[model samples]
Target chain A: MASPAYIAVDWGTSSFRLWLIGEDDSILGERRSGEGMTSAAQTGFAQVLQSHLDALAAPENLPVIVCGMAGARQGWVEAGYIDTPTSLSAILTGAVSVPGQSRDVRILPGLAQRDRQAPDVMRGEETQLLGAIAADAKGEQVVCMPGTHSKWVRVVNGQVTGFSTFMTGELFDVITKHSILSHAVAGAADVPADSTAFESAIKAAFNKPALATNLLFTARAGQLLHGLTAAGARALISGTLIGAEIAGALSSAGQGAAITLVASGRLQTLYEDAFRTLGLTYTTVDADAAVRRGLSAAAKAIWPNNERKS
Target chain B: MASPAYIAVDWGTSSFRLWLIGEDDSILGERRSGEGMTSAAQTGFAQVLQSHLDALAAPENLPVIVCGMAGARQGWVEAGYIDTPTSLSAILTGAVSVPGQSRDVRILPGLAQRDRQAPDVMRGEETQLLGAIAADAKGEQVVCMPGTHSKWVRVVNGQVTGFSTFMTGELFDVITKHSILSHAVAGAADVPADSTAFESAIKAAFNKPALATNLLFTARAGQLLHGLTAAGARALISGTLIGAEIAGALSSAGQGAAITLVASGRLQTLYEDAFRTLGLTYTTVDADAAVRRGLSAAAKAIWPNNERKS
Candidate 1:
């Protein structure tokens, strides 16, 4: 195995993922847990980090680079934010070091669109943006990062002109579990995915995003009127939220801007399907790889020599 | 005081209201409770009705007219629906009699729009529509009934052309109580209303309804970036939802259709503010009176003599 060069952690609101990178840019070790900011806040952020490092048996002096909610105001050490419109690479230079830590630890700052009309902020996605887009990329790009809070960024050349956050994933969750739609989607988890219902919902919401909430009601109405299955109801909710989000995100984008989607696992498949259903074209970047690559970029930028002795 | 003519009941998803109507159409007695459909389903619908009726000391032979969820499939009895493009008065004729009841009880039928693409159903609001709009009313009318499941009905010359059900109020409730935005709105109930924030959100969402979910996130972002208070966050969510709902509801209406708002209490005020913010003119109808009037219409149609010893 190549000797470990540095550590990279993507510490989000409810998730913790740490990666030990090798000198040759290979994965040397890995750790993942639910000890994200919420849990870490309760159980001391430094203690949580050290426990993970101890379990991985990482070197004592191995410098660490972090991104996401760990840098949030409520997070450890408060890494703060970098105001837009800023170069994507500005995140690399805006890393805030953790004070009183034995190891050299740094957390990347998030991006904040201080636009009074549309004020928005993003934490972990900024790192993903840093890694997903090429360093010398030209032309406009509409980058979408899907999650609990889906982010759509307007990138011109390397600059992030602005971005918008859609509460799509969280809304889906709450609506499915907490709203009247919950009864409509009960037992859906055991069934196979409903692509037809999903595609139709995507088209409907994409065509009339204003009718998004009304569209959500159709989950129950469809079941009552057309015998729509539980799986179909679930898909309808998911597709409607995503479709409306895409419509809003692209509303302000330049015509024919290259669409870049950074997502992993289920979200990756869902968004790709949405884009296809909407007849929109887009490129895909693995979110897991993107965040890791982002943390790696930050590590190399902060520790140029990649030397343990430094 | 005149003897009781009939008992009018509006039993909804989570609320139940009963009123004893005199021969003069006056409210002789009234009772309200949380024993709506969900609760009555467990406590026995007939028993719940009897408990409330007994509380009012209504005559044993007094006929009762019911509307709302009491007629749903899982309700007391499946009163079924009156399919649309039908006349509003059809609801009076379509009510189904509850079997084995001592009293002449009739459950009002809901309205169902089986448009294949936009299938929708409303149990209680049909009665409200019957009372809110006159039988001889002419021209196109857009009736806005704001509630948990807000029903926006399109009436053309007394005929129910079609309607849309927006899960606006329910979405607002769930998002506020269950989503991450819940944190942003904590303690909002303790603060005064923020009309400025609400109005701006209304305009923003009304103009760009597609950006609703994105606009919702601003509640949190606004707090972080602009020091927005909990009240502002609550208002933002409310306005965004209502604004989007109005935008969708009116999207298909004929140009300059008279807007009729049927609501009471907080919803009445909020939707009124929303309409004013969007520069839309609408006349308000007391929701309580509309439902009562609707039940009264049903009672009179079913029991024309209103005789206790029929």
Candidate 2:
């Protein structure tokens, strides 16, 4: 059995994931919980990390590397941000140390684009970019990371040129849960059972991205006038938001740029279908694997001497 | 004072307004409440209307004219709809009468555009349109009525051609209150105090409606990176939604089509500012007066002899 060398934690706003990495650079154990930055802030970050490590029976001296919102101003420690255009490797150098811990603890910094007109910032995803794209990759790449706030990042020859964050997922949640469309989608399946409505909405929004909000209204109007099903209405809302996001993302990208989608589970299937429906060229990367790989890269870079102990 | 001749009411989803008209076409009494369809539906629409009428001491035989959601399927009675491509005066003939009432009580029908691609409907706005545009008006007219669900109707030579509904005001409300942008604009003035942010956001969204969701994120990013004020964030959100709405509304409008803006109060000021910032030519009309005028037109058409009863 390979001995555990270090712990990798992705502490987001509402979720926490920890991986126990062996000396051989393999995952020995993992723990996931709702003890993210928000929860950890109240429960004590040190205590939360200790509880997770204790659950896994990790070694007391196991060095920990953390990413995501744990490094935010309101989180455990302010790791700050590396402003663009920056090399993916620059993130490694910006890690801030949490002093007075029993073991070495470092948190990765976020990335900020200071453009006055299109100001943007991203946390955690920058690490995923490090793992998803090879350090020496050639040409321009458009990377999409879909979640609560879907991010479309542009990379030119391994350096992140810029990126934009679309409030697609969050808007979909609010519109379906709080807006008038809520009634239109009441009792609907979360994933939308109506694929046809989803695809058509994708096309409609992609072609006329300007009519996004109007298209959203059609969910209710369609239900009232055309007797559209609840599932169909939900699908229409999701597809419209996703389609508009893609359109807006690509609008600023160089024509024919290779697309790299970083997502897993339902988001992966949805985006793949959207790209196919829009007739766009793209490839996919497993999000979980990418983030894990990203954490591994950071672990190795920060602790070069922690080689495999057979 | 002239004796009360009839009662005019604009009963909407969340609002109720009533005015007792005199024989001289003046307001004899006025009442306003929050007992719109949603509330009145539970408490009995007839009961709600009676309470207000009783307070005004309206004559037992005084007839009533109603518009807006009161005519909706779920309101007092199912008033149905008048299909589009019809004349504005056609709305007057489609009034549905409430049965078992001592006095004549007629609820005007709404307008419905059954276009499969863009199915749309409007209840109260049609009445506003009836009063906003003259029956014998000529040429193409683009009417912009801003509110919770802002309506943009396209009329050709006094005939209702088609219209679009943008969820601008509602989206702004949800995004600012329910979404992550809520934090960026926490404690900000309800109406944005940052005119610069508002105007800039308006131009940005109007010019690039596709990037709306992305632009929305800037409210947060701007705060984090550029130290944007809470008011600025609020203004940006409002401007983005309104800008996208205006762009979508004008996309189908004929070139140089005259714009008739029917709005009052804060909405009137906001939309007026938007039109001016965009350098678009338009004429403003009071929304309250327009709805009242529409109800008056319906009353005269339904009971010609009621005019100047004194």
Candidate 3:
């Protein structure tokens, strides 16, 4: 068995994921929990990290590299931001170290677009971008990272020119759970069951992005008038949000820019289907692998001599 | 005071409002409560209506005129819908009576646009429309009725052409209360205190309706990066929703159609401000008065001889 080289962590607003990386850049062990920044802020960040390390039986001297909300002002420490248009590899130089930790621990900074008219910021996604796109890749690329806040980033010759974040996933959550649409979507499965409804909705919203709110209302109207199934209502909503998001993202993107979608599982499938339905070309990258590779990049940059002793 | 001629009630999904109308069309007494269709459906619709009637202490022979959710299938009686493009007066003949009631009781039907692609339904707003626009009025008219579900209707000459319903108000409610923006808007007043931010957001969304969801995320990003206040966040959300709605609503309406904004109090002011910010001219109508006038129109059509005794 290879010895653990370092720990890579992605600490988000409501989730925490840690991977113990071997000297050969392989994953030795992984830990995940709901103890993200929000929880750790109350439970003590150091204690949360120690408990996870203890569970994995990680060596006491193993160093850790962290990304995401752990670097926010409200997180473990403030790592600030690197404003665009900046090189993707520049993030590796912006890591801020924890002062009192027994083991050497550092958190990567986020990226911020400071345009007063369209100000935007992202924490964990910058790390994902670091690993998803090659630093020297040619041509313009539009990368979409879908989640609670779906980010659409534009990379021109390997540098992030700018990005836009759409509250698609979170809006869907609030609408289906807390709005009147809750009744329309009640008892529906997590994933959409009606592909036909989803595709139609995607086309409808893509064609008339202005009618998004109106389209969302059709979920209930469709149920009441057309007897649209609960699953169909859910799909309508999911498709509408994703459709509008894609339309908005592509509006500012370069014409026919190569699309790279960084996502996994349900989100990945949904986006891939959306792109296909809209007839837009795209390539998919595993989100988990991207973030891990990003954290590993930072680790290697920070400690070059930690290679596996065969 | 003139003797009561008929009882008028707008029993909506979450609210109940009753007015005792005199022979001369004067409101002699009124009763309001939160016992709308949802509560009444569980607590007994007849009992709820009777309690309000008992509180008014009206004549036993006085017939009741109803509108809104009371006519829903899940309400007291299924009043059904008047499909467009029909005359505004068509709603008058579509009222369904509540069976087994001691006194004559009738509930007004809603309006339905059965387009398979953009199907929409409005229960109470139909009444508001009947009063907001004159039956004999000439030219194209676009009426904006803002509420939980904002209805934007188009009237060509005297006939109701078609309409669209935007889930603006409901989306605002859910986004502010249940989404991550909830924290961004916490401690802020119900209405926005940041007019600058509101106007700017309105213009931004009006110009690029496709970017509505992206603009919504700026509420959070603005706070994180620009130190935006709770008021700014709330205003941004409100402006974005309203701006996008107006853009979408106008997209289908005649270019020079006169806009009639039928709303009362808070919603009225907010929408008026939105219209002004977008430089769209509109005339205002008291929503409360409009609904009452609509009920009176139906009552008169049903019973022509029920005038004041000279």
Candidate 4:
């Protein structure tokens, strides 16, 4: 068997995961680093790369492919984002060369939407979505990846058509931490996340005779008017935001399209139920698994014509 | 004139300002501390207070009157909040007492709105609003204080009848700093604030379709459709958010009221003009001067028997 000869790195704001791939497109070993591009910006990323590789037998003559925030302008090197209706097939055929990397370490450009009413952009996540779509037969599907910045993507014919990110989690954190909503809800961090509160808030956010900003006041107001506790109020705020995102995405991208929630953990269950309650069809995929598969697929694309002989 | 005996403090989230208020209600000496309640959460505010006092000669046996974040939950001491439609009358008539070094000190409570559609709260700044209104006898005015958290307050019959806090500035900071909007504009830390750009954005924000959040995307979208520059696009976002805030506040509390903007600085000036354009009667006040007036009123409230003697 031909030994592993290349690496793929998924570097984001808070963490980094490295995959060592064999010539057969199988993972030989994987490593995780707490030092992501965002935090290790001043410490120099290439230094951390050497250490991460050293921990994994210090393999020689191996090229590295990178994705995510590592390509942000503030990253180790910028992997410029390509506009949407973007595809790996198209990117693979029309790739831009990033200069000055150790042993052919190339950064994958993100996907963006310029023509849309809102100019939406994505980085490493899109490449993974591309890898996911490439693994499937040509069909149109909506992939919802929920995170600090939740994105709803439209993939058609093995190509990423477009996507939009909702500042759901950040806004949640802001409103809860900074707004009076924090006083109403209790134990939000540790709450088992009762859907009753989330469901009701969703209904309020969409049906209210209100402004978007005023919705927040209702969070603080709910405590007084309805005796909503701090945690409950916060849960309502979360529900309202996520619910709004779902409603917005439905109206924008997945109005008639099939949907799959590419998320895991409790949040995955939440998304699944959210979609179900909305009468929207969705299937769940393991997040870590999807990322692994994506990194491997990207590795395969970076090196063509070389097959692993076992 | 009675000798200066007391100190009045209005310490808040980002900056601390104090007035050595003499018995005649004249400012004896003034000082400011970069150390505010927000940053000192983990570092012990008592230490900060001591250090600041150390700089100024520790005064004799006299009381200190303070009104602001020095009394929040995460403040030096949680002086608690007074529910809204709350006026200086209630605060002065029902003031809370506190212990101090060799003398007594009082921390005035911030105003909170529980009966309003949503529960909203404000501290420190309300005192300034009270002071501003106290200086001006113009009855029944809507006061706008714009900053990281902007407040549109209604003062009727010398009492703060109702008010709401808008997270306008913070939202702008977040959207510009962390969201996709960041990419549409330069991420330079010292980027100059373009008033023209800001004004245009405020106009766009108030423009029709009545409202749409994806509406803000026009900033980035215009860049694509018409090749808008980053500066102009950024201005649109700034204007849209502030405009939306004005719209939100207008619909929320500032509606159907005589409006006056009790704030200064280029940013506040921009908002004052926006409010005027929106057909709201708006006025601007110098923040520092108003803050001074607020402390004086608070001092007088605390020591009514010790009235300013000619």
Candidate 4 per-residue lDDT over residues A1-310, each given as its tens digit: 5587687788887788888777766778889978887777979888877788888874666877777888877888776767777665554433344566556677777776876445666667776675556455477788888877777888777777777666676666655654545566656564426577777666554443124555655665566446666666666677667666676666656477878777778678767766755667777777767766766666667676434422
| Candidate 1 iRMSD, 1 decimal | 0.5
Task: Place model 2 in a CAPRI quality band.
Answer: high
Residues A1-310, model 1: lDDT tens digits: 8889999999999999999889888998899999999999999999999999999899998999999999999999888889999998899999999999999999999999988899999999999999999988998999999999999999988999999999998999899999999999999883229999999999999999999999999999999999999999999999899989999988988758889999988999999999998888899999999998888888888898885543
lDDT (CA) per prediction: 0.92, 0.93, 0.93, 0.67
Q: What is the TM-score of chain B alone in each candidate?
A: 0.97, 0.98, 0.98, 0.85
* Candidates sorted by TM-score, best first: 2, 1, 3, 4
CA error at residue A55 for candidate 4, angstroms: 7.7
The regions of model 3 sitting more than 4 angstroms off are A308-310, B308-310
Native contacts retained by model 2, as a fraction? 0.80
What DockQ values do the models have? 0.91, 0.88, 0.83, 0.15
Docking class of 1: high
- TM-score (all chains, Cα) for each model: 0.98, 0.98, 0.98, 0.70
Clashing pairs in 3: none
lDDT of 3 by residue, B1-310 (tens): 8889999999999999999999989999999999999999999988998998998898888988999999998999999999989899999999998899998899999999888898899998999899889999898999999999999999989898999999999999999999889999999998898999998999999899999999998998899889889999999999999999999999999757789999999999889999999889999999999999999999999878777432
lDDT of 2 at B113: 85
TM-score of model 1 (CA atoms): 0.98
